[model samples]
Target: MSSIKWPKKRLKRIVRCKYGDSLSKENREKGDVNVYGSNGVVGSHNKSISFGKTIIIGRKGSSGSVHFSENSCFPIDTTFFVDKTTTKADIKYLFYLLGLLELDKMNSDSAVPGLNREHAYSKEVLSPSYTEQKIIAKYLDKTCASIDTIISIKQKQLELLEALKKSIIHKAVTQGLEDSVEMKDSGVEWLGKIPRHWKAVKLKRISKIQSGLTLGKQYSGNLVKRSYLRVANVQDGYLDLQDVSTISLPKKTAAGLELKKGDVLMTEGGDLDKLGRGFLWEGQIEKCLHQNHIFAIRPIKSKLMAAFLTLITTSSYGRIYFEATGKKTTNLASTNASKIKAFPIPLPSKKEQGEIVDFLNKKTTQIEKLKKNIIKQIETLELYRKSIVHECVTGKRRITDNDLKE
Candidate 1:
């Protein structure tokens, strides 16, 4: 667009890069120099892969992401680093050009999912004159930095909103909607203070806990193919029943394990943070049962409500209890029926529970709606960023002083 006739050049003539060593993440000692993988910096080390302008390209997993660092970098074997000295191209411009190519989807090796260096070399790129290239690169650097700053601020807002949601839930559940209500110690250290009208009751006293049967080939007894829930189906405060699968179970056994309309489904075990995650089951299917890895908590007392129970379990109180009491292995943890029953929950009046549930449902829906809008804004900004890069690098958009001023 700037009157510099873009010339086609074989990648090998303008780009130079090579493979690195097999330094896996666990083996390396931590240091100051960044270790570049295909997508970005994976870790840091005292030693560097190369000095000066380096463009790291994914050679295997997360293939084709283009990353450029001005200083020295160590790109691991799963990546390729192009030498800046060998090419007449502007390094920044080339990096933008690589992103437009979407090379990660061009994985050539079927078995290992790798980028063939020969395939990369055989491709052609449109080259702009040096002065025009610098103009375009400089304009984008300024524009993108400003856009990134906005994105960073928006991301922080999203994080703060999440924390605020947690605080609101904690206050509404523990302190009660009426601030004038007298407070008392919950006896549980995490639950420092609760409303005077509330009573801390062990889950076993208020609810009946049951786990589902594990499906296998040998089972017989009017075996019927029916849908069942696993850990994946139960998420924090909600169920994801979009991809339910079927299994063979005895009709009697399946009936015994069947979920009801008001049943609360919870994950038995998973990542440490994943424990105690669950939601209400609204009878998504007629003949569905959960797996052994999931727990079904049915209310035995009128004080407990399914929606209220979900909020409490997914709240900070539930997470803290699981982290401290659940049997933990490394980063993974699980809770058995006994442990789950032992959990303490604050019992409020049925009316108060319903009111709290309604209030939270309305508030969280607003927060979630706001969050979705912010997320869409971020997505739009990212798409705009990509469009600018493509337009400039591919010669669709011309760069001028007026453009730079804008």
Candidate 2:
């Protein structure tokens, strides 16, 4: 460790307002900065606290997050305030140091996690001289800000790439590759035109769609023996068999609705976004059937590739159609076989369909790889930030003039 010295018992103070009497938006007047829990800035108020240049800590709901403001501010019941001590400790340094501390670890494990003010006040914090503290804080502020800016730019780039992928999928499914080629009017309103050779057909004309068995009505005590698929098992573009639940269905029902490879599974009722979400079943699970809220789509193979059609149905174009036809309640949207059958699909020749699937497989594989790389970068940045905070606050790494110059 670099030679940096500070007194062991640095003086610090903790102050907090009484519960129930804390500031509120209604009671707070104009010109006051209102501070809430860890989330910060719930509302503004006119009343101001007497203390200036203080650090605030979230006391309940969201504990551990620290905030620093220049002037007077009112903290609500869910938070506590800490002003400067008379010792040589720097307030700004303390603010950043407190942020590095994971105070949520100290919370009581009740229905709503809470932090005791007295317990938090007694916690120890390492501190250097006020002058050195300011220098270290300034160095961190500048360096971390640059790193944060770069991370934000990378995040935005990732988002743009994702949007581009979505746009490509939407365009490919809605309109054929060649715009200027001869186009024929499709009978379906949504499907404006298709390649002259292609046709528009109802989903029902090309596939069999049916809901699964109802839940709770069937239950098997042994999850391993009777592992049945649930709505959770069917993700938007993939199947997650990790947490398959078991259900005891009658022997006849199991035989009637047994899932087969190549069958497309879809969710029937849920959030608007997930209403018609589906994936293809590629696993070999004997006696496995879908739950009540899922729909199984069995495609008629001549004109459709199971993978390609599933992708189109789960893409943005399909979402638009499903949303348009689904009946919306308070929190759920649903569609029946009739509505599903009426939905239009643009049908291409078997050769063209196969080519499109091959093209998508190549393109989507690259996109998925890029996404994984970006996710890894994000995780690395988070770990680096945590490491920096831990080393700096613990005096394991010391800030020097050379570091500041860099």
Candidate 3:
């Protein structure tokens, strides 16, 4: 086995500056990349800084994220700037190496997580020759770029599949399976057609929509250790119990508004695209109560499957209805009880509805599995990129320009 060694040295000669007093109104202008502190480029400014080919390390908020810019730019006070004199390190090699470091692990917990430059510079680093450094950085740039391209293609494929799934659901619910089936005019303006025997009815006809309980500030103190469901618990099409919180509420309140199995929960307001995100309650938690930001839809009949309604409400057709009726406030919009109740639904026979739900369950499950596999492939590619960078930068692996030619 071949062994490679990295020399240990003090990064003593590097010039460092904490991002502060670097911007003046005279020097600053709009449209230039404004180097933010921890949160990244929060805004843009025309002002430039003295650091050339340097690495900017976020000190607070987003500690340890390293950004390398070839041109002059302003660095915010929450960031630490490193210039060319920083040891004998190759700027590109160090940038790539820093990318591999999980800097979040080093954050000091105070009012906000932060990094101290003195402590950061004192940390140990493996060093290789400048020529070897360039070779490794160049190889990584090319290889990872290629891998990223493939991942991008796969991601687009996933998006296309999602669109196709929505199209299928929209057609199945609105037009039914039989292409030759006679279409009756849907009385509603947005709904163009319905199966000959199907009825078009308002959502109010089949379900009662009510917002969840508004736990007052006093209720915050009485939170119990039992599982509590909040707006975050409700995801796009399902409930995520991974980070469920425990809050205490009066037993009466819990019993009065507690969620049950087969209940459909929807977000009252959120990002415009997520305003009406709804999901079926699979009964993951016992005696769970929802926050006021969620709405519970209780069906009138056992024939109305919560899962089928949830699918319809989250479908493209449902999203259009939600967007049309939702009241916009800034970036968020909400669908009130009246609007939700007035929303139109295409009613098919209970048997046909069950068949459609079963068919979609099988198809969507397969698509979701494929999506998960593609996501894993993207993660593996990222790990491989990091490994290649580590090995090449540490001299364990070597790449030459001639290798690139081959």
TM-scores for the candidates: 0.91, 0.77, 0.84
Q: Candidate 1: where are CA atoms >4 Å away? A: 109-113, 116-119, 235-238, 402-406
Give per-residue CA lDDT, model 3, range 1-406, as digits (tens): 0124657543433334355444544555776665555665656686656356767778877888888777666777777766664446677677787776666567776778887666665656666667667767677778877888998998998898888888888888778777899989989777788888988888788887756767555564454545667887887666778987666676666686778887788887777787666788867788887777788887766456676687778677788888887899866787777787787888887888888888888888888888889889888987887787777656676666675653
lDDT of 2 by residue, 256-307 (tens): 6777778887777777877776678875577688776777888888867778
What total of clashing residue pairs does each candidate reach? 1, 6, 6
lDDT: which candidate is best?
1
Clashing pairs in 3: 19-77, 29-46, 223-247, 223-248, 224-247, 224-248
Write one digit per residue (lDDT tens) for candidate 1, span 168-193: 88888877789789999999877788
Among residues 3 or more apart in sequence or in different chains, the pairs in candidate 2 whose N, CA or C atoms overlap within 3 Å are 28-46, 29-45, 29-46, 30-46, 219-248, 220-248
What is the C-alpha local distance difference test score of candidate 2?
0.71
* Cα RMSD for candidates in order: 2.4, 4.7, 4.0
Which has the better lDDT: candidate 1, or candidate 2?
A: 1
- Models ranked on lDDT: 1, 3, 2
What does the lDDT read for residue 354 in candidate 2? Answer: 77
